[model samples]
Target chain A: DTAVSQTPKYLVTQMGNDKSIKCEQNLGHDTMYWYKQDSKKFLKIMFSYNNKELIINETVPNRFSPKSPDKAHLNLHINSLELGDSAVYFCASSADRGDGYTFGSGTRLTVV
Target chain B: AQSVSQHNHHVILSEAASLELGCNYSYGGTVNLFWYVQYPGQHLQLLLKYFSGDPLVKGIKGFEAEFIKSKFSFNLRKPSVQWSDTAEYFCAVSPWANNLFFGTGTRLTVIP
Candidate 1:
């Protein structure tokens, strides 16, 4: 069984468009996170939610918002997608803040 | 702010060769360290983790890492690598919270 899973493995959209990526975890983890991997393979944390509560918000632009309706789901919505927004976004979950995370197969977002 | 650094951007090796990837973090207090691998077209998966205890941690696929607190380093080592081992390896650290700070990954290409 897949512990962490993300929907729409690939997303291609034009500039000025909006898109959303859905993620879910079945590991009974309390924390979920969104990470962006740039073209150079530099992965950085964008947001983190613990039990549906916002915990860590990195220096990401407001155009990107993460919503966690419940402990099992954390979704990412990007508004006014730009060319620079084209990168792989990964969703991850962990039992707690200090535990190792289980990552979902990333969603490759391409903005034209 | 805590940060993780991976020195090698890309590494090339032949089958049966030994491998070592360097990872360093800047944190003084208690921390959790992890190594994750993403094979071609696959999701990220944890290889090994070091929370506390015997600094030397063994992981799947004949991989191991030693956490040296004095130097703030967690280096991954494999005595022998196969062509199937070619993948991108990432080093991450969690210092205070659940959010993990990841290093710019190291891509390993093992030629058979």
Candidate 2:
């Protein structure tokens, strides 16, 4: 069984549009995170949620938002998508932040 | 804020060759370390982790890492690498139960 899974493995949108990516995990994990991988393969944290509460918000723009309706689901919504926002976004979950994480198959976003 | 540095951006090797990837972190107080691997078109998977045990930790796919507290380093090593082992590796650290800070990834290409 897939421990962590993401929906819409690929997305194509135009500038000024809005998009959302869904993520789920069955590992009974308490924490979920969103990370972005740029063209240079730099993986950086964008947001983190624990038990459906926002905990970490990096220096990301206000256009990006993350919502966790429950412990098992964490979704990312991007508004006013720009060309620079085009990148592969990965969703991950862990029992806790101190433990290792299980990442979902990334969603490749293309903004034109 | 915690940060991780991966010294090698890209590496290439032949099958059966030994491999080593360097990882360094900047954090004070207690910290947890981890290594994650992502194969082509696949999600990231945990390779190894270090959390206040023996400094050396082993993970799946014949990968191992040693945590040196003095130098604040967790280096991944493989005695022999196969073509299938080629992937992008990430180093991460979390000082506590909040968020994980990841390093710039190292892309490995093991040519057969």
What is the Å distance of residue B49 in model 1 from its true position? 0.5
Interface RMSD of 2: 1.5
lDDT of 1 by residue, B4-105 (tens): 999999999999999999999997899999999999888889999988999999999999999998999999999999999999999999886686889999
After superposing candidate 2 on the true structure, give the runs of residues whose Cα lies further than 4 Å from its correct spot. Answer: none
Clashing pairs in 2: none
Please report, as a residue range, the 10-residue window in candidate 2 chain A with the lowest summed lDDT.
A93-102
> What global local distance difference test value does model 2 have?
0.91
lDDT of each residue in A1-50, candidate 2, tens digit only: 98889989999999999999999999999999999999888888899899
Docking class of 2: medium
TM-score of chain A of each: 0.97, 0.97
Give all candidates' CA lDDT scores. Answer: 0.93, 0.91
TM-score of 1: 0.97
The interface RMSD for candidate 1 is: 1.3
Error of 2 at B8 (Å): 1.0
